[model samples]
Target: MKLAGLKSVEGAHDESAWAAAWVPETDTRPSLLLTGSLDETVRLWRPDDLELERTSTGHCLGVVWVAAHPSGVIAASSSLDSFVRVFDVDTNATIATLEAPPSEVWKLQFNPKGTTLAVAGGGSASVNLWDTSTWQLIATLQIPRPEGPKHSDKSGNKKFVLSLAWSPDGKRLACGSMDGTISIFDVARAKFLHHLEGHFMPVRSLAYSPIEPRLLFSGSDDAHIHMYDVEGKTLAGAMSGHASWVLSVDVAPDGAAVASGSSDRTVRLWDLGMRAAVQTMSSHTDQVWAVAFRPSGGSSRGGRLASVSDDKSISLYDYS
Candidate 1:
């Protein structure tokens, strides 16, 4: 597999673009790109050409993450101020406003079955699960605090959760933390299962292979990406090449490869078979914060990858 630049929008937002996700295609529209930025706005874009579709503004602080519902009609954006706004994709009408404060929200994701929304609770050391239909706070899966002298400090930033990913089967949920621990949970029972350990720095991004539900990948501040067998409780492999922190990672729909964006201001395509970066594209002048592969089965024809950066730019790539 390889990545070729398709289109890039310079100054796509007034500030750093932090997070992105693909909205599935609807009957009247093609697959669209959704991005959140430090500008306190969430913007939608048409694919291939990447034309601006619309912009939704209401966030007081920078938007940290955006997630689209599997149905493609509704989506959610979480800001640094801990507010989560769920809105209509086409109409941009407010669907719901959610917050579990003083549990600040970081990364947000919709469960594969579309029944629940899993949010990474920054500083709260837990994953906040919300029921989709009722839009109510359902459960909080708390990560077990590590035994140490600092354990007494309940608000210690060491366990600040930064990112989250749900297994393809939607039976398991995994969250990454500031102290570099990946906590896995049993979704149905809402029970904390185990921790996947390796990196000593913060793990900023994680992804589970769509084809192999047990295979997990994580990118951390240590500038390395580690693959794990979540069910087996073992490290499968580690890939390194980035000159700076690996900020975000996403697995392709086909599960043939993975793409990552880094603080090195580069986007890399890693061949899963080789377990190495097969290509790197350095186009942005600032740190790349988020990378997402467009989900399959939309009006989208081929594989597409989107990356957002601190330079306030968005780049789209053709992956084949």
Candidate 2:
């Protein structure tokens, strides 16, 4: 499988494009591409052609993360101000503005079932989960610091939670921290089971196979992508090629491949069975902060991947 560049938008944002995610296709429309940037706006784009649809502005201090709910009617974006804004996807009207003080927010995600939203807590060393329907704080899954937090632990650093992913089954949750540890939690039980240990640098991104609940992929500052058997508690394999930090990762819908964006200013298409990078796309001149595969369902057709970069551009690629 490989990626063919279909469209590239230069200066898609006034500043750096820091994050990207695909809003699943709804009955009324096809899947849409959502991009967040340092310009403090979240813009929606029509897929394939990359036409601008709408720009939602409310965030401040730059939007660092964006996530679309499974239903496609709702989305979320977070800025450096440590606030997560939940809003209507079509109207851009505020649904909820959420914050857990003393605990900053990094990345945000909606579970596959769309019942909950998970936020990576920066300083609290925990994951804040909110009930989707009520938009109320439901639980906090804490990561144990057996050795206690080091004096060097700070609010915005990777020492705290930086990224998170939900298993395909929705029964499990995993979070990555700056100290290079991935914690797997049992969602129903609200318990941390164990840590997936290997990389010593911060794990910036993570994704679980859409087809396999136990298979997990993690990207980190170590510049390598590690594959793991989450249920088996084993390091399944590792792939290395990026010269810089692996900033983001996402599994293809069919589960045959993985896509990653990196500080190397390159996007890679990895063949899962071969455990090798089959294609590398260097269209961005700066760090590629996020890469996301459009979810398959409803009116969705072929495969598409969207990537946003610090170069202030958004690139669309057709996956085949």
Q: Which ten contiguous residues of candidate 2 have the minimum total lDDT? A: 146-155
How much lDDT does candidate 1 score?
Answer: 0.92
Off by over 4 Å in 1: 147-155
Please give the CA lDDT of all the candidate structures. 0.92, 0.91
**Residue by residue across 114-196, what tens digits does model 1's lDDT show?**
99999898988888899999998889999887665534556578899999999988999999989888999998999988889
- For model 2, residues 56-173, the per-residue Cα lDDT tens digits are 9988679989999988999999888779999999999999999766448889899989999999988778899999999999899998642435424554454588899999878999
- Candidate that would win on TM-score: 1
TM-score per model over all chains: 0.97, 0.96
